[model samples]
Target: MSEPRWLTDEEQHVWREFSVATRMLQAHLEGQLQHESNMPHTYYEVLVALSEAPEHRLRMSELADARKSSRSRLSHAVSRLEANGWVRRESCPTDKRGAWAVLTAEGFAAIKAAAPGHVEAVRESLFGPLTAEQVVALGEISTAIREGLSPRCAAAAAAAEAESACAGEVPEESFGVA
Candidate 1:
């Protein structure tokens, strides 16, 4: 293997700034969520993803992928959500071997109740500090990053799916049309 190329000085500075900004943003968001909603950032993300999903439910494996979380981590989170009466795990009728995590009525209620505060927090914590031009720049930057990363991400997801099938942990049919 060859030594990796070093970042240019400007690249290094931008990289460090990006890392710091990401950490600070996450900390601010998580702190606000905990204070106002009694929910962690991760839990809020899980709920957000589910709320946007079809029937407010997603296959457990798909949820894990969408959340960029591991199956075990999502399972534990869902278990906690279940205990809170916000979510429930059910076996998929279409696939006896598969399971789904469905957002409950209570979960929707909780999200509805929390949405205002969360949006306010988001605005105050980040966007409020930015000028309109800055917000546009941020959106452009995010789109670029997403466009650059998406193909590699999709390929990796496909590879992981193939590996899971080979390992007998997930059947290929799991990716079939819902």
Candidate 2:
């Protein structure tokens, strides 16, 4: 086998800093959401995804794919949300084995109430510390990284572009990765 490639000192330093920043940022966001909204970051993401979906509903498999979560995890989360009166599951009329997650009016209210604080927390923790140029660069860097990591995302982008052209509507943001 070929010898393994190793990071140089400078590369190592950059990698370490990137790892720490990612971890800390996630932790801070999760904590802030939990404290302010009484919901975990994942739950907030689910609500956001559903809220943005057409008719405030998405197929369960599509939701799972968007969230990058496994079937079991999504099922459990949906169960919890259902218990909280934020989401309800309905059997797909066309597919007996398929299901859809529908956001309720209560869920809409919950998201509306949570949005301001969540946005403020995100602003304070991320954008507040970065210059405008840095923010734009960060977005570019993030998209590049995501595209590199997930080939499917590139395909999805192309599909979205075609769909957008035909429908005359912009694709909604996918909150699954966040």
Candidate 3:
């Protein structure tokens, strides 16, 4: 194999900062969601994804992909949410092998209640320290990184948009963070 290219000092610094920031941001968001909403960040993400979907539901695989979670992990989280009366699983009508994750009325209410606090927490954790221009830059930077890391996400998103359009529902353009 050819010798691996090493990061220059500036690249190293940037990478380290990005890594640490991601770790810290995740931890902070998890803590905030857990404390205020009685759910972890992952659960919040699942609910948010479902909420943004048509009829507050999505296919299990779609939800798993949207949340960037393993199927098993999503299943477990859905179970927990089900136990809390926040979400329920439904077998897909057309696809025998497929299932759907539906957000319950309680789930909608719960998310509605939790959203403000979650937004505030996110703002505090990420955007509060940044200038307006920096926040704009951050959004661009995040989108670029996300696209680079998961090229398939863009295609999936496009497919979702087409599906939504056909179904007479508008696709959510932004990450449903709450």
Candidate 4:
């Protein structure tokens, strides 16, 4: 095989900028959430996803995939939220072996309390710094990346589900890995 082509200087700079921006943006958002809402961004995402899920519930495996987290991590997180009266897990009635994570009314309230601050933080840290055209460009770029990645992600998710079902367990590495 031939050696991989190196990035050009401009490409390298752009890539570095994107990485830094993403890290900084996450840090900023996390800080905002912690300071204003007493919650972590990841936990908030789980609550939000559950709130939006059908019947305010989703399969544990599916929730892990949606959050790009491992089952263990999600389990731990859900436990924490359950302690806070924000979430609860129930066994799937249709499948005795399956479980579903459900957002409790308290969880819905917490997310509702957190949403305004989160949106304002996002706006302040991101859109406030961008021009309208730049915002549109960012959206286009994000859509392009998602469009390219979604099929691969979906295929991997399906494969994981099938494999787990066949084996009667999720792989140790079944956690979503970016």
* Count of clashes in candidate 3: 0
- Which tens-of-lDDT digit does each residue in 132-178 have in candidate 2? 99999999999898879788865775686577759965233222221
Per-residue lDDT, model 2, residue 74, is: 77
Ranking by lDDT: 4, 1, 2, 3
Question: Over the stretch 61-174, how does candidate 3's per-residue lDDT look in tens digits?
Answer: 788778887556677888888889999888767766677889999999999998999999889989999999999999999899887978686577568657876998523321
TM-score of each: 0.83, 0.83, 0.81, 0.84
For model 4, the local distance difference test gives 0.86
TM-score of 4: 0.84
Instruction: Report lDDT (Cα) of residue 8, candidate 1.
Output: 98
lDDT, residue 9, model 2? 98
Tell me the tens digit of each residue's lDDT in model 1 across 78-112.
88888899988888787876888899999998888
For residues 45-72, write the lDDT of model 4, one tens digit per residue: 9999998999898888889888977677
The CA lDDT of each predicted structure is 0.84, 0.84, 0.82, 0.86
Model 3 lowest lDDT segment of ten: 169-178
